[model samples]
Structures are given as C-alpha cells and as structure tokens.
Target: MLLMAITVTGASTLTYFVNDSFISGQLSTASSLDTGTKSVQLLAYDTRDSTTLLQVSNLNNKFGDQKLCGVSCSGGGLTDKIPLNGGTEFIMIKIKNNGINSIFLENIKLNNVVHAWDSQTSGIALNTLQDLSSGGSYPHDGTFSIFSESSIIQSTSNEIPNGNTVNLLIKLGSEDDDILLNKGIKVLLNIGNLNPVEFFIDSGGAQ
Candidate 1:
C-alpha cells in the first residue's frame, strides 16, 4: 500500500508540470505574433488625361510632393485640373501594402478640412470609386456629402493582398460654383485602418 501511494503522487506531479509547460508555450507564441509589423505607402496622380499612369518614379515616393492643381496653375507646369463636364472629376491613387497580412479596406473617408476659403463652403462629394486591381471588387458609390470631421465618404469591401500595389480612381462631384469658386483645399484621405495621406489642391477658383 505504501509503494502504491508514492507512485500515485509522483504521477500527479508530472502531469501538473506537463500542463503548465504547454500553457507557457502558447503564451510565448501569441506574444511573438502580436509583434508582427504593418506598413503602407500612398501615391496620388492627376486624372487629366484618358490614359493615367502610375509612374515607377512615383511608386512608394510619399516624401515627394504629389499635387493636383484645380482650375488654373501659373508656372509650376503642373497638370491642369480635369474638367467637371460630367459633373465629376476623377482622382487616381495608388496604395502599396507592405505588410505581412492582407488589408481589408473597410472604408474611405475624409479626416479633416485643412483649408476652405469660403466659410459657407462645406466640402466635396463623391460619385463613384473603385480599386482597379485584378480580382478587385465592384465599384462603390460614394454619393454622400463630405465635410471636415464628417462621417465616412464611402464603404468598401476591397482587399489588398500583401506585397501588392493597387490603384484607386475616385470620382469627385463638384459643388455649386458659389462654393467651389476660387477655393483651395488641403485634405487628408483615410483608407481602411491605415494612416492618412495628405494632399494640397489648388482649385484655381474656377466657376
């Protein structure tokens, strides 16, 4: 009877140690996974011409100035503003996913209004937008009004695979001439859960 009792206690202690070791291993694995890194890069282009190109020089060059001159630009030789004949102007954007996992684009929104000449001038509106990448989702209409610190401009189900760069064409609807005339604005564009991208646009005060 004494020998049997001693053997039982030894087995119990071994089982407890084994369970504790397994729990510790799981915690260690989770900690390492939480340290995974995420990175994103953005580039913007003018949709002045029918054929828009995302030049190699502009790829991942967020530090360089990517600008859109509105109505009239003087001497910088910047591309002229695309006409709103269709009541909308298109803005092209490129996003590179440099992360370990795929990025699910939840929404695109305006972060804030950096500038607006007219106090009555609210903000820009959207017509339609989409990711022009292969296997991309269908276009989503962003017909909602956009103001500084306002609600989301559009909701999307687009996904950006890791190590892939995707192009996005955003159709901006023009407001009344009284609102957009001679106005310049700086806007911050937000994509999904990633960092915001800033751009300066000279509206050229067009009527």
Candidate 2:
C-alpha cells in the first residue's frame, strides 16, 4: 500500500503598483510583512521600467521673465523645479506570474528613505502602502513612508498567480530643476512571510 500527497489552493488577485516620487533614496530601511493563512509575495518588473522616468531636460520654452525683463533673477531664491513647463506625467504598471508557485500578494512597504525634494520639502518621505481592498487611507499620514534606496533594492516577492495580471495607476507629479540627473522614483515591495522577500532594482531610474 502507498500514500499520496494532496495539494490545496485558493483564489487570489495580483496587484500592480506605480510609485513616482523622483527623489534620491538614502539609508537602508526595511519592513516586515503580514503572515496570514494565505501566502503572498511581491516581485520586481523583470525587464526593469517598474518605476517612472522623469524627463527632467524636457522643459518647455514658453515663459517670459515676469519679475524683470532682460535680466535673470533667482525666482523665489530658487530655480523652479517644474517638468514640461508645468505639464504632467502619468505612469501605469502591470505584472505577470513568472514563477512556478501561484500565490497571493498581501502588502507593500515603504521606508523613511530620502527623496529628491526631502531637503526642500522636509518630512516628505515614502511610507507604507496597504491594499485599497483593505479599506484604509494610504500612507496613514505620518505612519508609513515609501521611498527608494540608494543601493540595490532587495525584497522578497511572492509568486504571482499564473496567468494573472493587474493594471495599477501611479500618481503623477511634475518637478522643475536646473540641475542634472534627478531621481525619478524607487519602489521596494515586501510580500508575505514578512513575505519579506528581497527583490533587486538594477539600472533603472526611479519613477
């Protein structure tokens, strides 16, 4: 006589995300995940482009010096950091299951990492992000922050359900700058099991 092993599964939904902060990340930060009966995980975009790309140099040349004509004056003692001469940029992200394991995605995390405007807008950091399905306000206003890291971002992402995909809308914000090379946005996702799996952010500007 022989015994057989049985497997069980449940229904789940894959969540896509778009994080656009355009801030330079700093310091190493981490957060634990929720370990519920349902298993969940988070994975990075395999081909990169997970975050937004700030076209910093694409400035519109259609403004007159309102303060003083024919003379360059420091506007408000600082250069206006606006993109597309006051236009907008929206980011949409999607994902698919690229692993053998089919699972659920429970939560995403954000650390108090530095952003491009942190110095100017002090206290504006990226924090925790909960599912809209959970029915709660995001960022929780002074609880969890979401930002990218200067180093490679590593987090454990659960296996997305096979043949599952999601279209997530990313918030769009424009910036102005006289400096070169600004950080777009960095998104680090933490799945289940503290999902706490470390994913990698390689060769992609933050969105």
Candidate 3:
C-alpha cells in the first residue's frame, strides 16, 4: 500500500473585552510529491454561512505547480458571532482526499490556547485532535478558557493512517459560556511522501 501522511499545526491569538463576541482561526495544508507528479486540491468551509472560504492549487508541488508538501494557517474565516464578552467559541477543520488513492494522516498537534483578558486576568486551555475515517465524523471537544483580556489556545499532536479522506472537528468554547459557531481557525497539515495528488473542499458554503 502507498504510504502518505498528512499533519497540520498552527497557533491563534484573540483579545477579549466587554460585550465582545466572535473569534476564529484557520487550518491549512501543504503537500509535496516524492515520486510521480500529481494534482492536489484543498477545501475549507464556514459552518454558519456554509461557504467555502479557501480553495487553492497543489498543496505540495515543487515545480511551480503551486502544490505544497503541507499547509499551515493562523486563521482564515472569522465570523461575527464569537462572543467577545469574555467567552469562548469553537472552530471546525475538515480535510478530504481529492486524489485517486488513499493518504495517511500521521498525526496532529496543538500548541496551546492562552488568554490575556487583562493585566491580572489571563488563562490557558489545552485540546487534542481526533481522527475520523473517510465517511466518519467526530466532534471537537469544547475546552476553552477565557478572560477579560487577551489569550491564546494550544494543542498537542495526533496521528492517523493514509486514507482516501479525513475530517477534523474542533470544538472551541470558554469554560464559562458556549462560543458561537461564527469564526474560523487555522491548522497546519504536514504531509509525507511526494506523490502526484489532488485535494478539494466541498461544503454548503460554496457558491
């Protein structure tokens, strides 16, 4: 079997205030080919607006094909619903295999989520990535910390095998309240093996 691995990672920072709502980030992937030339595509969605926020060319193409070995992002689609009134929200990451064969998802890692609400107000939250099969789905555990100032969120690493497609659902919310599903967050994908591959994103958010 062809062994292909894809991993994503990144960080995001958000500020909090009174009556504030909405915070988001993005997850991206960069792909590379080791042997043959392949076509790869990437797709992202906005669960609220049901829109495709990002659509790019090859994620891992070294021959000016606009392809990449993997992709990374800080934040992509930010909605206007994240509660800014000292709360939390959730972001979802969905990935697919637009190629002809199956790809492996080696692992995923999140640094941490830190908050800077104020000079004396701050906190941190940690989360992990769960694997879903081509047709399987999983919900991101909502474990977010909040403050009256600024803060950050971090995560650890998760792993998976090569397959046709994979989906990552991340839940973002504060320990006090539930975050609105408005903003989008960023995640990075580290893909192993350079094969001619193609990826695409499908969602109701598309035009």
Scored by lDDT, the top model is 1
Q: Compared with the true structure, what per-residue lDDT tens digits does model 2 show for residues 1-207?
A: 122222211111111111122221211112112322123223232112222223212112223221101012113421222212221212223444444456444433222221121122123322112222233121221112222222112122323454444322222221212111222334433333443433333322232
Q: Give all TM-scores, in the order shown.
A: 0.37, 0.26, 0.27
Instruction: Quantify all predictions' global Cα lDDT against the true fold.
Output: 0.37, 0.26, 0.26
Please write out the lDDT profile of model 3 over residues 34-125, one tens digit for every residue.
Answer: 22124223434333322112221111111222111111111232211121211122333445545555443332222223211111111223
lDDT of 1: 0.37
Cα deviation at 32, candidate 2, in Å, is: 16
TM-score of 2: 0.26
Candidate 3 residue runs with Cα over 4 Å from true position: 1-40, 47-88, 108-166, 173-185, 193-207
Worst 10 residues of 1 by lDDT: 56-65
**Model 1 / residue 164 / CA error / Å:** 0.7
Q: Worst ten-residue run, lDDT, model 2? A: 65-74
Task: Write one digit per residue (lDDT tens) for candidate 1, span 1-207.
Answer: 999999999999999999999999999876554322235565444333332223321111111122232223212332212222222233445556677777654334322322111111122232222222222121222222111112222223255567766555443422211113224445454434424545554332111
Residue 30's lDDT within candidate 1 is 67
